[model samples]
Target chain A: MDSLLTLLPMLVKMAIVVGVLLLLPLPLTWMERKIAAHIQQRPGPMRVGWHGLLQPLADALKLLTKEDHIPADADRRLFAMAPVVALVPPFLVFTAIPFGTPVQLFGQEVTLMISDMNVGLLFILAVSGIGVFGTILAGWSSNSKYAVLGSLRSIAQMISYEIPMGFSVIGVVMLAQSMNLSQIVAAQEGLWNIVLQPIGFFVFFVAGLAEAQRIPFDLPEAEGDLGAGYHTEYSGIRFSLFMLAEYLVVVMLAALNVLLFFGGWNGAPPFVPEPVWFLLKVGFFVWVFMWFRFTFPRYRYDQLMTIGWKVLLPLSLLNILVSGLWML
Target chain B: MEQAFFLLLAAVAVTAALLVVLARNPIHSALALVACLVQIAALYVLLGAPFLAVIQIFVYVGAVMVLFLFVIMMLDVRKEAQVRFLRGPLLPGLVVLAVLAGEMIALLLHSTRLHAVMGPGQPVLEQPSVADLSLLLFQEYLLPFEVASVILLVALIGAVVLAREDGASAAKAARKEPRGAAR
Candidate 1:
């Protein structure tokens, strides 16, 4: 009973974090529309609420009300299971991240983030890696040629990029000498990881983009060629879940980048709270992601493979070597 | 509670392992194998080797199993037949299986008699950290580690050589693809 009482507040905090994470998509969707529009010299979403701020609400309603569809010959179990699989890993990864230092709540200290896992970054990687199964299974079970091809591309893409992602982060882990996210952040007290490991930062950013299947790396759903790709058969909220999963992963990876490269909750001292600083940095990273999405052209499939395997993989290995020397 | 969790994980692992052999669809079998691997990882966690559990997930589920599933899906192996489990090697297979099972049962039954001592709720072995594991690997197990890598390298090369088609065969294979045929 005492343990239950102790866990009650922690559970509440977890609920709040989840609620906040769920709602984050709304503002992010708004921000994405606004940025993409400005990038293309167009006035974006300005009709829903002030400057179309409530646009995501309308979009969500539209999706929620839409008819869900499963094909006649599709694998029913797997087809229904794919989107949920896509949705889960990001939530787990998000909860593992430590957003800021602990805050005083009801005379007790509560950490801004959900959990400070000892192997937080590793836990993030493993769970997020499983998320690739979503796209793979989505394509395979859809019983569509295009979807299968897309899944092939997706599988190949992830396998190619995931290595670089792991190697890239190895530099940060080596410098911090810990797999704990909070410890990594704390280690950056004097200087951020980006300064110490510029190549690592660049590699991580690019790999992070690919990891979440952002534009330029979004070959799996190359609509022009593959007709919406793996999600060609999905409709309604299930489709929305895939998109939500992508965006959530993007946000999480961006947040991770900030924590690993930029100093987490580190900014010029002001009256603002720590979480606020963390959020602003994360928001900036998300904006940069959107900006890159708008600006960059998608790479050819072969080029993507070559870049991941030949360019980034070797570069990350070199970064590790250099970082090891620096650490020594 | 921990025992309950362990039992649940073990049950799932055992069932999934069975399904890996019993399932008709190759994809289903691959997925079942993945499920079994994941459940084993969870069981590892419940056993207090959280580091090993994470590595098990990372290396096995993340890389190996995904590639397994990818290959199975790519080959489009729709419906595999009820592969004869025993067929001609029934006696030998059963002997091996019985031996394996007996070994496992003996190990589990006599677990406490092995080296490591556990207290009331302690891990069977000390829950070593990543640093400790790495230190042991580089220090005492350094030669074995290097030998393992060399063996892995040879196996990788062998796999590539086996998988790669000769020029004529490559051309023939390429000619079978829709896009390649068009070109």
Candidate 2:
């Protein structure tokens, strides 16, 4: 009972983290539709509620009431498990990321993050691997040829891109000389990593875009080619889980990009609180994600592979060498 | 409390390992292997080697296991389980297993003696960071590390050669024989 009581605050904090993540996707979905509509010269989601702000809510209601699907040929257990498994790893990565500098609460420092491990960046990379498993499992369990093919593309893309992403991060780590996310953030208070490692930042952002499978890099869920790709068999809430994870990965990567490259919570501010600054920086990157979605045509399959390996990989390796020399 | 956590992990690890072998479907077996690997990573965390635990997940569970699942899914090995388990190599397998088990038991006994020499519970050693491990690899075990990497490079080249050779042979077989090609 005592231990449980002691653990209550931590549990509540975790609940808040997950709750905020869940709620963010609603507004994000609405914003995505609105932005896409404006870009294409049309009004989007104006009927559901005021400016379609409540559209996500209506969509949620519809998804919840829809019949849960289980195909007859599908493996029963893995089919059920895939959506949930997809959600866990990104959430785990979220915990290690620091939202802002620690705040003072009752004369003690209260951190916005769940835990600050010395190897927080490594933890993020490791958990992302698990997310890849979740994607592969979803494809295999669906027992659909299209789903399997999409998943194969995703696996190859993720594996190849992860190398560049890892190299890009190593450059940042070398500059910062620490893997702790908060320390990395603190180190950027003076000049930000962007000024020092611009190439690394660009590489990290592109690799992150690929890692999340957004837009041009979204071969795994290529709607036109693979009939919704890797998730053709899914419907209702199970399908929503994949979308939710997709948005969460986007948000998480945006926040990480802000923290790593841009000055995290460091701005020309005498008014806004630190967390708000962090959010604003993240918000800018979120808009960038939407902008990229509308602008580019999706790459062909082989082209995507070539860019990941031949282009980004070599560039990231060069960035690491440049960063090392610059730091010395 | 620590012991309780350890017990929980141990039970899950053993059960998942059993499922890895006992489950008939190859996909199920691969998933079981993932479970077992995750539990082992948790055990590493408990042992205060957090760096090792994360690497274990990153390299083995995250990357290698995905590849394993891919190959298994592509091969569709579920229909190939017609033969009885351990039928052909039953005797030698049992002998090897017994010897392994005996070695494990002896090690456990030796560990208990070592504990007696120190105290009841094993003390927590100073935690090593990633920098320390990297330094050790580059500075102390530099030659061995370079040699290992060279070996990996060799294996990578070998795999490419073998794959190309197989593809060439399959093309030849298809043109000449029209059946019994590759498979």
Candidate 3:
């Protein structure tokens, strides 16, 4: 009876988290279009609802009703499974993220997260990286040259950028002296780690942009070269699922950036609720992500690789060395 | 309950690992590896080594294996080509497998005799904190860490050198291009 009581709040929290995470992509998708429209000097979906609030819902309904199409020569099983594979990891990663302090409900202190693994940072990274496999598999199974090329390009970009991204976080890990995201955030109680680790933050931010497959680093999905990257063969809800995964990744990266650099739930005096502060920080990063998409041009393949390997990797290494010496 | 969870996790880990080896396509293999990694992480949780589990997933599954998948995809090594390995080198592989199994069995038997005090009722083995791991890494293991860094640096340099197109070859190719251009 006691165990069941303890488990109930956990179930509730998990439901809430999943519910919120699933919903966030809707607004984010709308935001992407609206932002792009505004950037291009257009009104952007004002008709759907008040300021096009229901546009994403409308889009969803349309996609849901659309005919599911599969290529004749595609590997049927892998093709069917690819979207599920892509979608699960991002959802799984949300489990470890601590939203707020534990709340007492029915005589049990229920954590506001699904799971609080010690290696929260690593878990996020690992799960997110696994998402790439789905993309690669989708491309391979599609038996389309363009899809394969796009997938290859994306995988290469992700792998190249991840080194610098990992290294960038090493400085934060060094300073926080822990790999636990919650602990790392807690360590920045007084001062945010971003102030201390600006270079690390910068590298991570850039690497994240590449990882999210946003513009400038969005060579994989460049419409000019590769038609819609790994999802070229996908249509209907499967296509939506891929897009949802991408946006969720954007959110995840933003949240992670906030957690790592911006002192996740930490805020000024008067103590804004932790979740609000966390959301605000995440929102800020997401906006910045949108801004980057608007601002930068797609990088050429060679140039992208050069920036990742030549510029970001060496800079991150230097940042680590400098931080290590400083700490010593 | 905990024991049941551990057994389930172990089953998942083993199955995923087997799938990683058995998968025909490289992409499928990579996906299986990811499953194996996540299951291993679950096992880590069951063992109360949450930190190690997370790091295992993060470093090995996330970064390193992603690179492996990326390379495999880029190379586009055919699934049929990869299968040929099963046909060759059977004896050496069996010997290696036997040696590994023997070592693991020996280690398990040895550990059973040494009854170290663990946290009461729980399999909590007083594992070092992240701070302790970092301290040990940067202090005691500093030389080895530095050596590994140097090795990685050398590999990076070698890769760049190998990938670069030679100036003389480019010049020769440019010279040959004019013959076709004149027509």
Candidate 4:
């Protein structure tokens, strides 16, 4: 009973997080459309409700009602499994991220995060990397030339960017002398990592953009070229599952950026709570992500590879060297 | 509870390993291998080595398996359902499996270290924290760690050298053809 009582807060937190993550894409998709439209001097989806507040709801209904189809020659089992495989890893990543400091609940102190594993940073990186399998599986199982080519390009892009992304965090790890996300955040009480390791922040942000497959790194889903790329054959909820996963990744990256570089919940404004502060910072990054999506043109495939390997990789390694010298 | 969890993980790992060898499609084999690696990582976690478990997933499941899938996909390797994997009498394979199982049983039954430390009723060993693990890795086993890294570096360089030779030959061919010549 004592153990059960202790587990109650964790179980509740998990429920809340999972609930929010599922519903999060609704608002995010609406936001993306509105932003993209506004940027192009247009009112987006105003007919749905009050400047299209209910647009995402309508979209969700349509997707839910749409007939899901599997291509004739596609691998039936893997085709059905791909979206689910893609959806899980990003959700698993949330388990390790600290939302705010612990709070008292039911006479027990409860952490905002599900778990604060000592190797939280590494665990997030590792688990998030596994999300690639979903894309690869979806593409390969579709049994189409476009799907295979798109997935192959995506895999290459992800693998290339991951090296720089991994290296970029080493500077923060060195500065904090810890791999725990909370510890890394706490270490930045006096000064944020971005102030000390600006180059690291830049590299991480760029590599992160590529990792999330946002434009101009969105060659994997180049609609112009591949007719919706890996998901050309998918329809209805399966396609929406891929979209949901993408949005979740964007949220994950935004939250991670705040935690690693923006001092997480640490800030001025004593009246505001810590979690709100974290959310505000994360929201700003999310906006930046959306802004980039609408603003930048997609990079040519070879250009994307060159930027990842030639530019970002070298820059991250150099940043590590500089950070080490500064720490010394 | 821990014993039951370990047994579950071991069962899954063994099954996944079997699937990896038995699956006709190369991609299926690769995915099965991934499942096997993940189960092994879970076993690592059960053994109280979260760092090892995470690295196992990160490197093996995340990076290495992606490469394996990439190669399999790029080459368009598909189902060879018609081909027999073990194209001979089953006797030789059965003998090998029997001998391996027998050796394992013999080692478990007779090894003093196993009996002293890991046998039933023996207390479990204390697990080292990640900090302790890293300290031991960097301080006690630094030379071996560095040597392993060097070995990996050599392999990487060898791959680059091999690729460079192909590039040079391609470049020579391009030079001989000249710009905008006949098809």
Candidate 5:
């Protein structure tokens, strides 16, 4: 009975987080299309609802009703499982992300986060890393040349960029002297890490873009070359799952950027709540990501690899050195 | 309850390990290995070493297994499916397996003696905090740690060198075989 009582709040929080993540991509897809259309000097998605507000719902319905597809040559089991493998890890990542500090609800002080491991940052990184398997499995199981090539490119890009991404966070970890995300945020309460570690922020942002497979880093799904890349063989709801995962990753990256660099939930003006500040910051970052997607051209695969290995890797290492000295 | 959870995890791990060996498809075997590794990671969490568990997933399940899958895919091992897997004599393998099983049974039967030495209700050792673990790794065992890293670096260089040589030879062969029909 005591354990059940303890578990109830967690179950509630999990449901809320999952529900929010599932619904987030609806508005996000609409916003992304609108932003892309405007950037290209055109109105977008006006047919479904006001400014195509109901467009994603329509898309969801169409996708659900569409015939499920599997190429005859494809591995049946893995093909069916790929989208799920891709989707779950990104949702799992939110288990560690804190939207705000603890708040009183129903006479209980409930944390905004689902779990607060001492190694929260590492936990997020490790789980998110597993998301690559989805792409790989999808590509392999499809038994298509383009899918294979795209997945190969993606895995290589992800693996290369992950080095710089992991290293860039070292500066923040050193500055905060803790791997706990909450503590890292607290350490930045006086001054954001971005102010102290601009180079780290730059490397983290670029590598993060690559990690999330956003343009100009989206070589894995390069439409011009790979014909929709790893997901070329997917259709309907399964395809939507992959898109949902991608959008969730974008949100995760945006939220992570806010937490690590911009001081998560900090700098709230009087009468404004911490979570509101956090959401505003995260929203701005998400917009910035979309803005970059529209503004920049996709990178050449070789060029992407070079930037990750040669430029970002060394820059992040240098930033770590500078941060260590600054700490001293 | 804890014991039950541990048993469940152990059962899954053992099953996955068996699948890794028994599965005919190389990709299936690799994925089974991943499942086994993940179960081991859960066991780490059960034993209260979450840092180890996370690293296990990050390094082995995430990176290493992905590489394994890449190699399996790149090799185009679909044809390898038709080949027989177990070729060795069964008697020696069974004898070795029996001996190992006997040893494990003996160890389990005598585990009470080991517990007696350690005192009651203290089954698992307390894991050190991450900071202390890092301190031990960096300060106390710094030499060994550095040496291990240097060895890894050397192995990496060696792999690159071997791969380069293979690529060069393959390129030479390709150049020599003009209008080769047997590609």
Candidate 6:
């Protein structure tokens, strides 16, 4: 009975995190559109509700009310499962992320995380990678040439960039000597790991952008060529799910960059509190992501591959070497 | 409770493994492989090696399997085509599978004996935490790790060369005059 009572608050926090992540994508969609509109010197989403504060809510309602369509030629089972597959991984990755330090609740010290597995970083990477399967499945199951091509491109782009992304983190892992996010943040007490591993940080930033399929590296979803890319055939709520997953990926990437490179939840003054500092740091990266989207043109597919392989890969390897030497 | 959980994981692993082998569609096979890998990771967690489990999921399930699914999908292999089974050498294939199955079953049954040989009632060693694993990987496994890097470099170079060869061949084909023009 005591144990059950102790577990209740932890479960409640877990529910909140899941709910917040699900709801986060809605506002992110509005923000992205508004940012793009503002950059182009146009008014955006003003009529919906208080500069379109309720725009996402309206959009969600519309998508919910829309008809769910499944093409006759499509692989029925996989097509149905793809969106769920895509959405689950990002949500699951949120489990290991420590939003705040452990607090005493009902005489039990419970951390504000769904789970703090020993290999939290790797678990996040693994689960996030699984999200690619959904994209691939959606593309293939659509039975359209454009969808298949787009999905192939996405998979290749992700795989190519992931090598550098993983390699880039090798330096940080070396410096901190840990895969645990909390420990990594704690190690950055006096000075952040980013100070010592600037090359790794840069490589990770670039690779992460590519992994998230943001502009500049978004060749898979290149509107000029592949139409809507992997989700070309998807419509209604299915399309919304894919869109939500994309924005969520953007948020996840920013959050991960904050946790990995920046001192997560740690600030100089210590007055701002850890969670607030974490959110601010994450917000900074999110803004940078938006800025990049506005500023840069998309790279040619070959160019993207070349930069990932020839540039980021070798640079990450060198960063790892330098980190090792520095440690010695 | 632990036994039930372990049994559930085992069931998932076995079912997924069978699906990977038996699925008519390559895409389905890949998904099954992902399921099998995830279940294996769960088993690794039960065995008190959470780090190994995560790495297993990360490297094999995440990176490698995604590549496999990508290749399979890109090739657009038709699921309707009947797989040519045991075309010439049925006996050898069966023998090989039998041997493999026998070894797997033997290992499963004798694992307890093997554990006893290591020591009776000896505590199962706690795996090094993520921090310790990183330290040991750098300190002790440095040589092998560097060797792995070299191997990856070689593979990267090979892939580049192969890609260039294909590009050159395509360019040559494009440069050739039309056969009708020659006529």
Candidate 3 similarity to native, TM-score: 0.85
Give the TM-score comparing model 1 with the true structure, all chains together.
0.92
For candidate 2, lDDT tens digit of each residue in B1-183? 889999999999999998988787888888999999999999999988889999899888878888888788778565754533556757898899899999988876778775677676767767777788889989999999999999999999999999999999998877877554545
TM-score of chain B of each: 0.72, 0.80, 0.67, 0.82, 0.83, 0.79
Candidate 1 Cα errors over 4 Å, as ranges: B79-103, B106-127, B165-169, B172-183
RMSD to true structure for each model, in Å? 3.5, 3.0, 4.2, 2.4, 2.6, 3.2
Question: Per-residue lDDT of B34-126 in model 1, one digit per residue for the tens?
Answer: 899999999878776778888898889888988998888867475443454446757887799899999999987788765255436553655
Clashing pairs in 6: none
Write the residue-wise lDDT of candidate 6 on A1-328 in tens digits. Answer: 9998868887898889888888888777788888988998998899888998899999999988898988889999999999988888888888888876777767778786788776788888878877888899899999888898899998888888888998898887777777888878877787877888899999999998998899988887888999988898898999899988888888888988888888887664557766777888887888889888988999998899999999999999999888888889
Give one digit per residue, the lDDT tens place, for model 5 in A1-328: 9999999999999999999999999999999999999999999999998879999999899999999999999999999999999999999999999989899998999898999888889988899999999999999899999999999998898889888999999999988888899999999999999999999999999999999999999999999999999999999999999999999999999999999999999999999999999999999999999999999999888899899999999999999898888888
lDDT of each: 0.87, 0.87, 0.83, 0.92, 0.92, 0.85
User: How would the docking of model 1 be graded?
Assistant: medium
* A77 Cα displacement, candidate 6 (Å): 0.5
Query: Using Cα atoms with residue i matched to residue i, what is each candidate's TM-score against the true structure?
Result: 0.92, 0.93, 0.85, 0.95, 0.95, 0.89
Model-by-model DockQ, in order: 0.62, 0.74, 0.54, 0.77, 0.72, 0.78
Which clashing pairs does model 5 show?
A: none
Error of 3 at A102 (Å): 3.9
Give the true-contact fraction for every prediction, in order.
0.48, 0.81, 0.77, 0.74, 0.61, 1.00
TM-score of chain B of 3: 0.67
Evaluate model 2: give its TM-score: 0.93
Q: Model 6: runs farther than 4 Å from truth?
A: A105-107, A268-271, B79-81, B84-120, B131-183
Q: Please write out the lDDT profile of model 3 over residues A1-328, one tens digit for every residue.
A: 9998768777887888778878888899888889989999998899999999999999999999999999998888989998988898889889888876666767767776787766677778767877787787788788888898888888788788878988899999888877777888889889998999999999999999998888888877788878887889999999988888988899999999999999888874476877887888899899889978988888788999999999999999999999999999
Give the clashing residue pairs of candidate 4, or none: none
